[model samples]
Target: MSSVPEDRFRRSPVPLITHGARRTVLRADDGVRVEALYEPSPGGGTAGPAIVVAHGFTGSLDRPAVRRAAQVFRQYAAVITFSFRGHGGSGGRSTVGDREVLDLAAAVRWARSLGHGKVATVGFSMGGSVAVRHAALYGDGSGSAHGGRTEANTAAHADAVAAVSAPARWYYRGTAPMRRLHWVVTRPAGRLVGRVGLRTRIHPRDWDPVPLPPVEAAARLGTTPLLVVHGDRDPYFPLDHPRMLAGAAGDRGELWIEPGMGHAENAAAETLLTRIGAWLVAA
Candidate 1:
C-alpha cells in the first residue's frame, strides 16, 4: 500500500464520535495518526477511571457496536475509542494485528499518561487482540505487533484489564487459503515496502509463523483480570476460540459463553453489557 499523501492526513479535525463527543488526535512515527474519542464522565466525577473500547478486524471507533460498548462503559468510567489507519477516519493502512497494536499502545499511553487509575480494554475479534497485547505490555513490556513489539501477550497486567471476543490463538490461523493469502500479502518484497515498513499508507500484514500469538502470550501476562466472551455458534473462530482464550489466561481469565452467538457479533448486546460491566467491577 502506498503512503497517503502528507496533505491527505493533515485534513481538518473530525468529531471523534457522533452526538457532540470530544476528540483527540495522536500521531505515531512514520506519519501514522489515530483518532481518540473522549466522552466526558457523567456526574461531575473527576477521578473516574477509563476504559478503552476497541473494534474488531476491519472496525473503527465509529462502529455501532463499539459506540454502544463505549456508552455502556461510560456509565462506569471514562471511555475512549479510535480508528486505526485506513480503517475509518484515521491515517495509514491496516497491519492486521501488527502495527495497529502499536496504534492501540499509543491510544493507551494517551489515556494512562493522563493519570487514570485503572485502564480497562474491551475488544471484539481483532480488537480483542489489541486488548490482549495492551495488557501484556503493562507487566513485562515484551510485546509488539507488526514485528515491532510482538504484542502477543494476551493476559494483560495488574493495572490493566482486558476483555476479548473470538480471539485467534495462532495469529496465523494456520489454515489453507488464509495462510497462502497472508504470505502473498506480507512477503515484504525487497525489505522496503515501496520502501515501506507498515507506515507506507494502509498496508496490512497477516499472521507470521514467527514468535507467539496473543493467546500464547497470555500465560506470561501475569494476573491482569481478563474476560473471555465468545458465542458458541461463532461461524469462523467457533466456540473453541473462547476455550483457547480461557486456556491462555488460565486462572486469571473469566469466560462468558453466550448461548447462540456466532462469529464476532454480539447475539445479545444486553447480556454482553451486563457481563462486561460486572467483570469490570469485580476487577
Candidate 2:
C-alpha cells in the first residue's frame, strides 16, 4: 500500500481535450455506494465505445496500475473505473466475486446513463471473474446462476467483455500466487492483513451458494464478444484458465496468450491494452 507517485502521470489544472475525466459515486443495487472515475473518450465525447474497468484483488481506482490502464483506455474510448464494494471508497465487504456483480452492474448502468450507446467491460484477475459473471447474468437478459432471471439481470448488460488473468474456476490453489490468495480469503489473520495492508476487505468465509464459475458464465455469454487475455508466464492460474474460458465462449471469444506477460493489469503491456481497445471498438 504505497501511495501513487505524483510524477507518475502528468496532471493538468483542467482535463485535457484528449481525455476529459470526472469523478462520481453511484449506488449499487443493494444500496452500497461505489466510487467511480469517468473519463470521456479522447476529444470530448464517446467517439468509440465506452469502457468500464474492473480492477483485480487488492486494487482500487487510485492504484497506479489501474490508473495506467485507464489512461490508455481513455485514448481510445470513454472509460469508467470503479472500486468494487468493500474496496476503496465503496461500501460493504467483498463477497469475493459472488456479490461483486452488483457493483459492475451499477457501473454499467451509470455509463449508459451518460449517453454512451455501446459499453464494454474490462476486468483484471478477481475483477475479471466478476466481469464474466456480470456479462453472463446481466448481458442478454439471461437468468442468474442462482436460477431464474431477475429484473436486475435484464437491465444491466455489456456490449462486450474482456477478462484478463481471470480464473476459470474458484478456490484454485495450484500456483504459489493463488495459494497465497486462498490464505488471504480463508484465514482471519490473512483477512486482517488484506484489510489493513492491501486495503482489500474480505468476506468471512466461502461463498454460500457458490455463484457460477467464470468458465460456466463464459459458456452462457451467447453472442456477446469475449476476449480472454492471459500471459503464458502468468504465475496464477496458468494457461488452462484462459483456454477454458475461450473454449466455453466458443466462436464468440478470442484468446491472447502473451509471450512474456506475467499477471493482471500490472503485467499487461501498452500494445496489448491498445489492441484490447481496438477489439472493443470493433465489437
Candidate 3:
C-alpha cells in the first residue's frame, strides 16, 4: 500500500492490480474518467452479488475509511469502489450531489460488466444521495428518466440500494456542517480549499434545473429494495432526513437509526457495515 503518483493510474483504461484490488479508469457515460477498484470476494467468483460503493463528498475510493468499508463489504460480495468525478484520480468537477448520479451509474454498469449477477449500491453522505437518485432513475431497467434504454441507463441499474447519512432535500442549511458545506461548494475561496486541502475538484456552475431530491427519488425506487441508515447523533442532517426518505419509500424501504453513530462512512461502526452487507445479500 505504498503511496505512488496518482497521475500514473488516473487516465489509464487498462486494469492493473494495485493495493490488493484491480484498479482501472472507467469512462463515464458523460465521458468523465472515473477511477475504480474491483476486488473479488474471498471465494473468488463473479456470478454472485457485487457491491458498488460510492464515497461521500471529499472522499475518495483510496481513502482509508472508504477502503475499509469496501474490505468489510467484500466479505459478503465482490466490491467495486470508485472516486466520483472531481475526486481523487477521477476527471471533471463535482456538481456536489447533482450530476454525481452519472458517476454512480457508470460504476454500477461497470459492476454488471464484470459478470456480477446481482448488484447492490451502497453510498455514504453525498454519495448516498447519488445512490438514491441513480436507483430511482435507472434501477428498474426502464431507464426512462434519462430518456431511453441506453447502455448507460441499462448498466446503471441496481437490484438493491443503501443510502447512509444522506439528506432528504437540497439547500438545507440548518446544521453548521451543512452551512459550511454549502460555502465550500458555492464560493471560489471555499472551492480552492476543497481542491488544495481536500483534494476534491468541484464544478463552478450551479444546478441548472434542480435534480430530484433524495426523498422524491426514494419514492420512485419501484420494487428495488432500499435501506436508509442514519445516526441519531449525526452532525449533519438529523433523523428527520432518514425518516422522510423511509416514509417516502414506504414498505419498499427499511430505516435503521443507529444510536451513537455520527455520519457517513467515517462514523459507521464495523457491526453496522457488516449488517448492511448481510442486508444487501438478503435483499
Structural similarity to truth (TM-score) of each candidate: 0.74, 0.90, 0.92
**Model 1, 213-254: lDDT tens per residue?**
777756666867678887665554556767777788888877
Off by over 4 Å in 1: 1-20, 29-31, 141-158, 171-211, 265-268
Off by over 4 Å in 2: 1-19, 44-48, 142-153
Ranking by lDDT: 3, 2, 1
Residue-level lDDT of model 2, residues 1-283, one tens digit each, is 1122324444423333223567889888778889998888757485457899999877888876778788788777888999988899888888888888989988988887887878999999999999999998877765454345676555578999999999999888898778787888899999998899878888896877888999999999978999999988888877999999999999999999889888888778779999988888788
Error of 2 at 136 (Å): 0.6
How far out, in Å, is residue 3 in model 2? 18
Quick one: best lDDT, which candidate?
3
Candidate 3: tens digits of C-alpha lDDT, residues 1-283: 1112234334534333334568889887678999998998878588899999999999898876777788788889999999999999999999888878888888888888889879999999999999999999897677776678876688779999999999999999998888888898999999999999888899999898999999999999989999999998888897899999999998999999999888888788779999999999889
TM-score (C-alpha, index-matched) for candidate 3:
0.92
TM-score top scorer: 3
The stretch of ten residues in a row with the least summed lDDT in candidate 3 is 1-10
